[model samples]
Structure formats: C-alpha cells, structure tokens
Target: MNLSKFDFTRLKNLLPSSLKSLSINPTSDLIREDENNDTEFYSTPRFVHHIDDRARYVLSQFYTYAIQQTPETITLDLCSSWTSHLPENFIGKVFGLGMNELELKENPSLNQGYTVQDLNQNPSLPKFSSNTFDSVICSVSIDYLIHPLKIFNEVGRILKPNGLFITSFSNRCFPTKVIRKWLYMNELQRVEWVANYFLQTDTYFNPMTIKAYSFFDGNFLPITDEHYVDPMYIVSANKK
Candidate 1:
C-alpha cells in the first residue's frame, strides 16, 4: 500500500476521526535509506540548529506552558543534542540521551547528566525507573525511530502518573535517516501518526496537537515580509 499516492485530503475530510488509526505494522515502513548503522550515521557531531530561531522560540514558549512554569519539574530529553529548546526560565532538572557524547555534554540544559545511546539499536530506557520523570520530550528527532512503539512504551513507563510526553518536529530532518513512512505523509498525517503512537500504547490520555508557528503568527505580529518560518508541530499527551 503506497500511502503516498492516496489523496489524504479527501480521506481527512471523509474520515477525519480515523486519522489516528494510522498504525505501523511490522514491515518495511521502518526501513530507512540504507542498511548502515544509525550510530555511524550520527557519529559526527553537527552543532547546527535544525529549525529557525522563531521556531525555537515557539517551542520554548510551548514548553513553558506545558510544564506550567514549575521549577521542580523534571524532564528527559530523548535523542537530545546541544540544545533542548527549553526556556531560559525553566528552572528544572534535565536529563539527556543522545548518540553523540560531545553533543550531550555540551548541552547546558542537561543539568541531571546525560547518556550516550543509539535508541534505534536499543529503545529500552532500563536505567530509568518507572514513573520517574515529570515530562519526556523528543524535539525534532522522532521520525528517525525504527522501533517507535517500544520507545513510546518506555517513555510512558518512565513518566510519572499524569506526566506529559511531548514530541515536537518541524519541516527539517535528515532525509536519509528519517523512516520511510514519515517521508510519505503530509504534515497533518504526521501529527496524527504521533498521536497514534500514544493511542496504540493505551498508556496516554488527553492527547493534543499544537501548531506552534501558526499559533504565534496568529496571536503575535503578522508577517508581511517574505521570510522562511519553519513550520512546527507539537503532539503531546498525558500519562494515564
């Protein structure tokens, strides 16, 4: 089934409620650009920001709102890099897990130490106790997961009761590293796919999606000049 060929616009209009039903069967949908190891792919530390400054600001604002400005909140950043996109006022503990040690170590936001691990090879977060974190965040890096269900389950297990699991992404990604299914879907479907991650696990509730850039644009100064604003989407849910 080449989902890329389907008119998702019509499907969305006809079966809007069924968008969350997009499930990834154990198949080639998980395949990436090559048989090469993901560790090797991410071995080099790329310190560049994937999204624009505006997008980063939007994400940071959303984080502030989601975490409710709680100074005692604890967060786990999965597939983290040099920056967690957390607000400067976010006075909380941040734990980071990423493939590159240099990248993780350089992240000042990670005050609770960091772990270097290739999640594609091992999705389990065994070192983390169950219900340990107030929130688990994956920023701009969810599409590369080959075993997302396992990872999502681990996130659910690590989150405290009523804790939030938030995944944010933009129009940017390493095309070669992103999963095949992700390449086929449009932005709206991708949002639904992330929601489905929570739905399939049956461990999360009150799922919500936020178009950060759009929200900011509508509420703040309207852009009249031609400039590139990276489209950002955040799909989040609360642990049941």
Candidate 2:
C-alpha cells in the first residue's frame, strides 16, 4: 500500500491547491483559532451530528456495510459520541467513549459502557487489554484529534491483531476544536497525515489494503442534507 493504495482517483482534481505533498507547516496561520482558548472547549455538549443529511445517509451506508465486513463481536468507537451509525442487527457489543455525558446518554445504541477520553491533553485511551476488539470505529471526529499518532497507537493496542479501524470524516468540522496541524492539510495531505499516524506508531496497520472514497458517487443527496462536503475520506486499516 506504500501510499498508492489510497485511491484518490475521485479526488485528485478536488484536492485543495494549498497541499500537494507530504510538506509540513511549521507556522500556525491556518492553524490559528479565531476562537478564544479561554473556553474549556467541550464545556458545553453538542448533541448533533457534524455532516448534513445527505452526508449522514452516506455515512450510514458505510457503517451498515462495515459491520458486515467485520465479525459480530466486540467493537470500540473511540472519540465516540451519541448516535453511532451502527446497523440495527450488528450482533456486536458497541462501546462509546466521548466527552459529553448528555450526548452519550442520548445514544440508545450504547450497550453498557460510555467512557470519556480526550486526545488533546491525554492521548492515552482508558480501556486497554491489548488487541481486545474486533473493530475500532471513529466517525467524523478524526480532525478534532490533535495527537492522531498516539490515538492510532492506542487503537492498535486495543484491537485484536486482525481487527480493523474505520476512520471516516467529511469536509465539515468545528473550526476551533480541530488541531492546527490538521487545519493546514489538504485532502491528499490529509490522507497521508492519517497514514503517517500508523507509520509513526509502528502499528500493524495494512497500508496495501487502505482505500479512500469520496461520497460524490453518481447519486448526490439533496442540498437539504445536513452534512457539508466536497469530498470524503474513509480508510480501513487491518491490524496485522
């Protein structure tokens, strides 16, 4: 997969001009937050999904199918929130870990556990037993995480050797909460950034099987959909 497996065919032209390679931005212009850091950030809970309706449908479709690919057993949704897009009959146990108590409470899908783990200050996740889960799913919140390498490393630590991590995100995000490093990266660079997360941690992620899909597939959702999107990135990396 040495980077080639990341199918950006549908996204080559759409990639933001600002990014074209593995370049790093040492400055914090694009990274700068107009919002004041005085706020505790997640002090208030957001009980809503980030993407529009159309995007949500597409996101749901991905979730429904992803469940089929993996076994019906233990699953972890790190940086998880209320309303995880799991199939009705997933036959697996779903564990959600996020910041908001109200949001997690609203999610009827959470089986028994709802833990909170933030990656900005503490990169280490709470649950640990080494390769314990069959799947690790992160929804549209990947951009919000500052230390992806650390998070991904912890993901690898929790996932069973053959388990997979489904990291998906769209163009929409909370500007201030997202890290400066991610804010500066374009689509292609974003993919590389995520892949490099696995690389940096020396995880067992299989790059050869890595793939990216833009939701712009033939069927476009009505403009009324809640999600905001130009392109999407969904990658599945298997734990070796």
Candidate 3:
C-alpha cells in the first residue's frame, strides 16, 4: 500500500465519476452488517477448485519465479482456499485464513490451521499479528471484497518490510459472489484496478508489479482425449 500520491482528503476525486453497470447487481455482503453473522461462510464444506489446471500451472511458475526469496519465511495466505501451493522443499510456517474451516481442514498442507472469518464483515483480519509474516498471497479473491483499499492497508500493516504480497486472478469468478465493482471491467482493466487498491492505501508497497501468464498459446496436452479450454491471467505486486 502506497499513499504518497493519494491525498486523504482528495481520495474521492481520483476515481471516475461515471460508473457503468455491467453486472446484474452487487453481491450480498459477505458480512452481515446488523448482528455479527461472521460464522455463516464457514458453515459448509465445499471441496472445489476455482480454476482450471492450466491456470494453476501458471501460478506454480509464479511461486517459483516471484517468490524465490521465501524459504522458511513466515507466510500468510489471505482468502486462502484448499491450497496455497507451497513448494515441497520450502520449510516454513504457513498460516491460512479463509471463510470455511472445512475447506481449510481439507487442505492437508494447511493442516487445520485456518480460522473462519468473513473479511467483508470485518476488514480486521485478527488471525495474524503485525509484522509477522514475510509473505502474503491472496489468490483470485480480490473481486469479492466490498472494501479493498482498506484491506490492502491492513495487509501492509501485518507484513514485514520488503515482504511480498501476491494476488492472482483469471477471467473466472462466481458472478453472484463477485462484487459489482469487478464485473464492470474487462480483464486488463481489472489488473489496473487491483494495482490501485494498493496505491491508494498506505506506503508499505513498492510500485505495483503486474504480470500476465498465457493459458492458451497453441500448446495442448489431452487428458482422456477430451477438449478443454483454459483462460487465465495473473497480476502480482510486492509489499515494501
């Protein structure tokens, strides 16, 4: 999060005044505003992977190239799901925090380590201590945040200096679960939107670095001789 160019009082002026509605409607709040219903997101266990194998392979490359520096580094997998894709050779304490405890439990690698908390209800991610984790990765979940700038600022607060914050996404998402803000843009614009979330928050990040991996480039391997299509793009940044 870097706030050098974002004046607190002038924040509203930075965004475009016109907003187009390309979505059906905004998704229901992940957090119940009235009575603290934070436990609902964890009520059920869903053993589902969000993206295709091709996209995941791209993410694996990211773990290798972008996170080459992290070994035994305390890590936080934000909006964590069934897996954080930690390399087998990496020995470290990986903390996972997600909405479903069941999903966390299913992640044998996570080893029953996640807490069930709805961030949209409480942007306060109370599971980790400040300056604790060396790296944080949020995979494809930024579109669900009703409030992102605030969340990025908090991400900066909990991360150590020079810590890396990796956020990756594709063109896929549960349209009903994704916030209205995300549906209104094309894929490339979504990358810029994510970058600004860090820029408008605090001063804990270096200039946002963006990367896109191609899933379809005329290379194909068939499983069961069935045709499959993979479309995905990942954008990442570092927390300074």
Candidate 4:
C-alpha cells in the first residue's frame, strides 16, 4: 500500500487529551530501567538493524523528506549506530553519536565524523559547539533516554534557529532497557510522550506535528500480510 494512503485516524484517536498534562519525576522508577548502566549494556557491538528492512526503508524515506523540507547543511544522528537509514545520495555531512566505539567507527552513514558518548552519563553535548548542526535526528532510541529533557535542551542549543529536530520510533525495542513510562503507554500515547519531551523543554517552537506511517493496522497485523512490518511514527519540532 502507498504510504500516503495509510489511515492514521485510528491511531490518532487513541491519543489522550491529558497526555501533555501528564508529568513524571525525572528520577522516578517509571523512567528507570532494569539495566542502569547503558554503557555496559551497549558494550557488545550489535550491528543488526532494530527494525525490519521495509520499516527501515520507510524511515529513510521520511528522513529524506525531512532533510529536503529543511535543507540541512550538517546533520547529527543522536544515539546512532551502524546504520542511520539516510538517503543514499544525501548532500550534507552526517555525524553520529553513539555508545559503542566500534559501532560508531563502523557506521557507513557517518561519512563526516562520529563520536562515542553515553548521553545518560552526560546529557549535555559538550563535545559539539553551540549552533553547530542544522538538523538533529534521534531514531527509535527516544525510549531509552533517562534525561530526555536535558538532552532536548541541548539539542535546541546546538541547532540553529529554525532548525528541525526529528524523532522517530516504532513498536519494537529492547524491553528491559526501555523506560517504564514508555512500556506502559500504548503507541499513540508514546507519540505524545515524545511531543511532551519537546514541549516541556520550552526550547523548541510550538505546534509540533505528530505523524504515523504504518504497514499494519490497529490489530498490529500487516495490511497486505507481507512479512510483519513495524509501524513508524514521528514527532517533530523546530528550534526557536
């Protein structure tokens, strides 16, 4: 099925009005995970793609569209790994920040440069100067954030005015590492959770858009019964 033709209303209706009003203490167990040491957990290099190929293609298409929409000069892939799912002929330089050193070094997508740092330990992007990147992307890794507010603020600081920050996620994740708040909420609420991350930071422009592109329906079954494909959703905002 064509991506544009996919019905998102069913998913949209699941979002609660009180989602934005919801709050949790940053140190609460709701955001904590079974494995606290992210560095240790990510020590072993896992080169595998978290989402399936079709989902990856869908995400890459969205990334391409976002890049074209904003026309980035330089991009940063936060919590990135071996693959960024970027368009093949992307014009701008792409940098990666990840936990595993070997994974960052091996990533073909980070043609420009790459660094290894645990954002949980130091939520601040001290390595990069202020206003350095035109675009920032965090793909499928938002649920793993323990200090999302601080990280989002850092993203806003690093982004130039009017720059875009695109965050995308799917149904799949390492459950043990995913935060309790993320695990408990359904997909639609998870979308709002990301949006709230942007809103509460007060560093990005308002009216952030939440979008969904699913190969499956409300039942979590594939529309075409093609190999199971994970649904993709994005929440995006511009730096003020």
Candidate 5:
C-alpha cells in the first residue's frame, strides 16, 4: 500500500477511544489472522531470506554500525532463523532463539549456540542470565510477536547496562502471522508503534528510529523512491 494514500484518520477513528490517549496496549491489537499453533506453523524448516538482497545488505551495514562500539560482544538473536544477518566483520558471540531447532543450528552467525523456543507461547527467557548480552537483535520478525512488551522486558533483563536492542523490519511479513494492529498501520505509524514499545518498557532509553532504506518516508526519513526496492525501517534502544 502506498503510505501517502493510506487513510490514517479512518484507522484512528476505528481504534478504541482509550487507545488514542494511551500507548499501543490493546490486547486485541495482538490478535493474528491465524491463531493456530505457531510451532506447527513454523515446523517446516524453510531456509529463506524474508527481505531481498539489497535490504539484507542494508541491515548488515546497520548492524555493523550499531555494534561497532561494543568489543567482544555477546549478542542474542531473537525470533531468529537460518541466518542472524550479522555483518561479515562481526566477531561477536551470538545465541539464537527461534521456533525451529534445525534452522537455528544452521545459522552460521550463531557462533555461541541456539535455542528453540516460541516467544509467542513463552515470552520469558529463563535460559539466559541477566545482563549477559551486549546486544539483542530481531530482524523482520517483530510484527509477528503477540507478546512484544513481555519479550521486550525480557530483552532488557538479558542485556547489560547500555546494551543495544535493535530490531529491523522491511515491507514484508507472513501476513497470517503478523498481528492485526500491524496490518492497520502504515510505515510511519509502524515505526511509532515500535518506538512506543520501547517507551512503555521503561527499562530502555534513547530509542532511535531509522529508515534503513532510501525508499522510506517517515518521521525519521523523508526520502522517497521510485525504483522497485524493498523498504526497511529500524528501531533501536539502549538498556538503562
């Protein structure tokens, strides 16, 4: 959908009046089109990139730029899969959490190890210790999270002081799995929605939103693209 033509006023009118005065806190907003067991839905190990090559390159470059200050970084890849999408120069020890063990094991970027857990079913990270990781990254998978606030809290618990929690998403997703709220939002609103998640967490600070691709036009980036390029947005914050 062209963001410029989206009916934001209609969407706002459709929302509960309380939501207008509050953050993204409605439980109904998290409902998915497909409520079937997520484990079963993701049981098949499909090793594929959700975003295109150019978008992937942009994500890798963003990762490199984001994690450059932290040395010997211990990172967590949330909602991870067959690839963590870390830059080639990244030497960080990475742990992955996902629904498919086969895919997680196949991720070369997960140098430390991998765990198979459905975050939608269990938002807790009981296996990880507090302040254990220097960074946590979720790529193109945040839209599918049903219990995002809980997961964000877990990310804060697992991250060290000043640790980075970075999430990036493109104009692509498993439509049936994505939350209903995400479907109603345009690109700019989606960024605000993510930024609000960080704000509500309270444990995170200095939240930053970026248009990782040149095609995006949001509060963070006002550029437009006529070419057929995948648009990507990034929302990142530091653990307080």
Candidate 6:
C-alpha cells in the first residue's frame, strides 16, 4: 500500500472522541516494570487463560466468524499461548509464535507447527517466507508490544493479499509489561490506538474497523458487577 494514499482524515473521523484526543509518543518508555526480559517474566509457564470464560467465548465466536469469512487454511497465532480459541471444527493448520515453548507445546490448535520467538527483541518473522499465511491473529496480547508498528508491518508482509489480521484485547494485562500509551488510554481510546497502528504502518487496507463486546449481559458498557467480567475489543483489517 502507498503511504501517500492513506486517508488519515477518514480514519480520524471513524475513531471515537476519546481516541481523537490521545497522542502516541513513539519514543516513550513503553515498559514500566523493572524487569525488561520477557523471557524471565514468562519463564514459568502458567497453563491458564488470561481473560474470563465469557470473554473467551466472545473471542471464540469472533474468531470462528473471521475464519469462516476468509479462505484461511494456514493461520499464524502471534504471541500465542496454551489455548488459541479457534473453533473445534476449524480445518486449518495453526502455527504458534510465542515466548514460551511449553505454552506453545501445550496448545492443541498448533498441531501444524510452533516457534518460540520474542517480537520485542526482533519484530521481523524471518523464519516464514512472504505471503505464507492466510490469516494472522494476536489475541489479548497487543498491549505488550513495544515495537508494534514493526510487527504490524511484518504481519502485512507474511499475509497474502486480502488476508485478515485480527487483533483482540481485553481490560486485563500485566501492568508492568504494557506500554504507557496502552496503560493510560481508556478502552475506547485503546481501540483507536490499535487502529492507528494499522494506519501508521501503511500496510493494511483503509477504514479499519473496531468492535467491542461486553461480557456483562451482552451490553457494550464495562462490567461493573461483582462477578468481574472482562470487556473484549477487536480491531481488524485486511492486508492490502
């Protein structure tokens, strides 16, 4: 995609009011924790789901629909874990690229292959050739990326033309690992931030769409009840 042809005005108009006011300082210190080593942070494998059950279900529903919409036979799960949330009937080969080998090995969906690599240290996926995947997904883990734009561009390069790149997140994250921009922004603003990633990278098709699904009674509002449900948000775009 041509960077000059990007319609920033149209993209800005589509964003929420909160996102319009937020600014991204690319030079800022994204990681707040004392430990910068992601390997150490994720050293002990936690065989557990990050989000709640309801949020997982919503994510699964979205993933199922996304896979059905496209001809995705080979999928790459970036920053993946033990569970990929793919539909049981999905007949595709899912590959896992994550920090922990144990987590990737535990994932049943990654029957095709799996690799242990840190995107923060190296954003590029040199192992895979260009246009190797039909779809790329990063579930509930976008906030941890310090070099998100580089990773986004890598996603564009590896995906076939018109292939889908789906990024889903929720209210939960390791506070120290999340970037300052993501940690400071509200849920709506964070949606725009992810959209800006797709736009600024100049790798995705125009008119990036953002969708929010609340775990609280299916309403868009955040869950304020005692049950403590996490609200899910998705920002998706097609490779140009």
Ranked by lDDT, the better of candidates 2 and 6 is 6
Quote the lDDT for 28 in model 2.
52
> Model 2: residues >4 Å from true position, as ranges?
1-39, 68-72, 217-231
Per-candidate TM-score against the hidden true structure: 0.84, 0.77, 0.74, 0.86, 0.82, 0.83
Candidate 6 C-alpha lDDT tens digits along 182-233: 7778787777788878777664544444333333334445457556667777
Best by TM-score: 4
Candidate 3 vs. true structure, TM-score: 0.74
Task: After the best TM-score superposition of candidate 2, give how far the Cα of residue 20 lies from its true spot, in angstroms.
Answer: 12
lDDT of each: 0.77, 0.66, 0.63, 0.77, 0.77, 0.76
* Model 6 misplaced stretches (Cα beyond 4 Å): 1-23, 69-72, 208-226
Tens digit of lDDT per residue, candidate 3, span 1-240?
121232222322222333222222224433223333435634677677777766676665556555634345677788886777655555566778888776787765564277767887788866667888777888878887776766887888898877778877877776756766666777667766776666555377665332333334443555335565455555455666
Residue 30's lDDT within candidate 5 is: 92
After superposition, which runs of candidate 4 have C-alpha atoms over 4 Å from their true positions?
A: 3-19, 69-72, 208-219, 222-226
Lowest summed-lDDT stretch of 10 residues in model 2?
1-10
Candidate 1 deviant stretches above 4 angstroms: 1-20, 69-71, 204-226
State residue 16's C-alpha deviation in candidate 5, in Å: 24
RMSD values for the candidates in order, in angstroms, are 8.1, 6.5, 9.6, 3.7, 7.9, 7.6
- Looking at model 1, the pairs that clash are none
Model 5 residue 10 lDDT?
A: 37
Q: Model 4 over residues 1-240: C-alpha lDDT tens digits?
A: 566554333434233444454586766634665756889999999989888776777778777776733335889999999888887777787899999888888888797888899998889998888888888999999998888888999998998887788888998899888887887888877877887787687645444433333344445565557755677777777887
